[model samples]
Target: MIRFENVSVTYEDATETALHHVDAHIPEGELCLLVGPSGVGKSTLLGTVSGLVPHFTGGTLRGRVTVAGRDTRTHKPRELADVVGTVGQDPLAHFVTDTVEDELAYGMESLGLPPGTMRRRVEETLDLLGLNELRDRPIATLSGGQQQRVAIGSVLTPHPRVLVLDEPTSALDPGAAEEVLAVLQRLVHDLGTTVLMAEHRLERVVQYADQVLLLPSPGAPARLGDPAELMAVSPVRPPVVELGALADWSPLPLSVRDARRRAAPLRARLEGRTPPAAPAPAPEAPVLAQTARLTLLRERVTALHEVTLALRAGETVALMGRNGAGKSTLLGSLVGLHAPTSGSVSVGGAAPHRTRPAELLRHAGLVPQEPRDLLYADTVARECSSADRDAGAEPGTCRALVSELLPGIPDGTHPRDLSEGQRLALALAIVLTAGPPLLLLDEPTRGLDYAAKSRLVALLRDLAARGHGTVLATHDVELAAEVAHRVVILAQGEIVADGPTGEIVTSSPAFAPQTSKILAPEPWLTVPQVREAL
Candidate 1:
């Protein structure tokens, strides 16, 4: 269904080809998984299949590309829309309608489908994606994960023969991600649809892929082969694969079930052994932020309800919950973006809502879900320079932080030109340069690959060691297992569970990491834990 003929893409002013000369074939009805580190041209390659490279992105395509037998070079994106359904990393950019139901119907309307057929598809999609409850909600009001599902449903309703998704489940919670992936699986098995997906969270989708397509690095040819064969050599792999390697399991396991099936002897070896204790703030550590009975409402909807939480110096807390469950709202309240309907929130001994903008920088700083919200400069260097100026830091302070978090970023490259993970790293560097007593990050690992995420974990650990307080709101359970000392789970704008990282995630099946699930009854949360135990 999709074919790349010696494809290579070079954007205007780019120093290197985003994608090197590559050739691969994705037969019809196959779920092809694209694997690569961030900014290595996964997105650029996906654009070629959907004809968005040269047509919409102003890049030069040197080799031929085709989708459903139509050459993408000759066919524009709109021309191939009927045969291809593309969902990019950023979901908000894909919406044209205000409400959930309208957005789903709009795509079919564009295709000039019959009214009855459109209505039937809309209902099917809403139910298939579990968006029936959100059908009437305005797109702007939905949470990031909810918005992601709506964006996906909008495309699926078109029922294109080929589906191209970039980070489709990046914003979704565990349950929602499974539902969406199951829907895609159904499409491939029952409807004979083709899916080409690129995702950073391999643990969630790698098991479902029939073929793995890898863009190893910049200026490197792509490789297409069996999932297990490619994954054994892929730099980016899921926790199960990592564990399989750690234990020397032949033919690496791709899913938790497969890993668990082979973990009996390993589990016996780990009996009575304890994982490292989660990090904790010192008893004498100062309290940096406190929310006392905080209640917040937005547009007559309660975003946070009577949530009382506290963060101490040297503590890292992860705020986790399903989409639209008040995680982002709580982060917003910490940064003074939302005024609580009742109760109070304080950072560094001052109410965040009452603190002045310049003063708030000294107290706390927030890197929101949309990193672009904090970035205004044109070039990467200018953004760092501006961050230094705004934070009252010495020259090169922010640049050094950027170099640590996101190395190899060009000084003159546009901030908008960077990949999703690169952009987040830049935004994080800008915020961290302030050196605030408290740090707040919402969905910090959205587009970051494993290597980038490891750097982030190290950076956050360093910050915590230096006595900085961090409140991270994320759906990446593995990330929480790695960095968060404590976790707070919210539901329907209320805090339901708050405990240490190992206890909370391991106790809950929905929130447990892959290793934890595989090593169940052992209380393991990560590959390192299992490795250490053995």
Candidate 2:
């Protein structure tokens, strides 16, 4: 069992304690979920189990953290490595080896395991994770999902009694995310390994958690208990739970399947009432931007090849393809971050490359996939206001816009100190506050929970309603289906498919929705949508 006895943790160079006298226990062989809004010390709490908080990160640690009956303070990461395996938000950050086989063996080899044992464990993990086919492949060549699995497999090869994963699926598409989660579920059910995970996207994993730890805010204490109880008290509850609350159901459902099971009676009662009118069809989209014979050259890579497309106003366009299919590069080319090798790209009738970066802020705003790097401000409020003022926005309007985007952030908190999700939200707020006519978002929902994602979707929908043209490049097909009017698939630096979101997702095997793979023929994005659809 892992036990935290009144553990209060403060990072170096920070005034506030990330964890506050937190007492928690994660029993051996139990799946524990550490969940919270951005920057509530969930990651810190997980770090304690792996001896990373005070040992590796140089934090002020109080109280005792005991794992597998060993005091964590006495055990360094390598000393406790065999007992506890940790996977962080960016899986690629930890990799030291080139191939999948070497990665899995690295951990075991460090533990002084025999060559035979390492080889056997490596092969076992490869087969267990379905990486046998790609065992010899370079880590750089694997897809995001594949890389994440390899990371997990590498850690698990040590045969740790406890596995701690921090937002493992945040960077993956829903389909790929589901695949990773399935492997984790198998580890718990089959191997009886205690799985403790901290994630923002609760809707995807909440159903699998045996226990839930809900952290309210940064510097605040966390509450731990039953999943249902945690959800009941959580301010950032999933839409399915919210729908259950609205339906007045006792003991809210955690999964869509559970919600469906309970909604039969609720549906019968709701069927008695008159249903609301169908939503008006979205306005016919008109071309707002165009790329004619566009080409992008990135060192030795040809990111885009003679790509031609039109993005219409009031249209939500999603760019979908496997990683390295040049999704990020294509989006970069659109914003002049990567100047086109040949041909022209125009936004709102202005040439993309010719427009100054500051001038482009008036016509288009690009939210890069990795938004944390975009933030350099001291405080969240200041950060949000900085870009808007740079773009000549009114101070009041900028504040108003920031408040709308992140209602959770306090006024004076340091922007750099905010959690990854909150920082992403802050970056998006900075871009949106500029009030650009064309908005480009690359993987906007990477580290957000269902509540945050819904808020983002609603915000984007409102933006589209207000006539802003939004282009979202993402692996999230669910997000695409709900918000986008059209889906554009890019493969091998060329446009493979472009059409209506529903048509593209529902009909194409290569471009199908991930949510549909879980619960088919539903045509829904949220649990509420599923409930309503049925």
Best by TM-score: 1
Q: Global CA lDDT of candidate 2, please?
A: 0.77
Residues 249-279, candidate 1: write the lDDT tens digits. Answer: 9899999989989999889989999898867
The Cα local distance difference test for each model comes to 0.92, 0.77
Please provide, for model 2 over 1-534, each residue's C-alpha lDDT reduced to its tens digit, 9 standing for 90 to 100.
Answer: 889898989877666777887888888778888877766687788888899888887878999999899898988887888899999876777899999899999998888899998998888788776778778888976655678788888898888999989888766665567767887888888888999898776767889999987787766677779999889888677656777787787798888778777665655554433322223225576667889998877655677888998876677789887665777777776677777788788877787777888877778888886677678888777775677678677776666765665575677777655766777788888888778888998888877766677789899888877778888888766678678877898887889889877668877644554344334444433444545644
In model 1, the worst 10-residue window by lDDT is: 525-534
* Superposed model 1: Cα runs more than 4 Å off: none
List the pairs of residues colliding in candidate 1.
none
- TM-score per prediction, in order, is 0.99, 0.82
Question: Which candidate comes out best when scored by lDDT?
Answer: 1
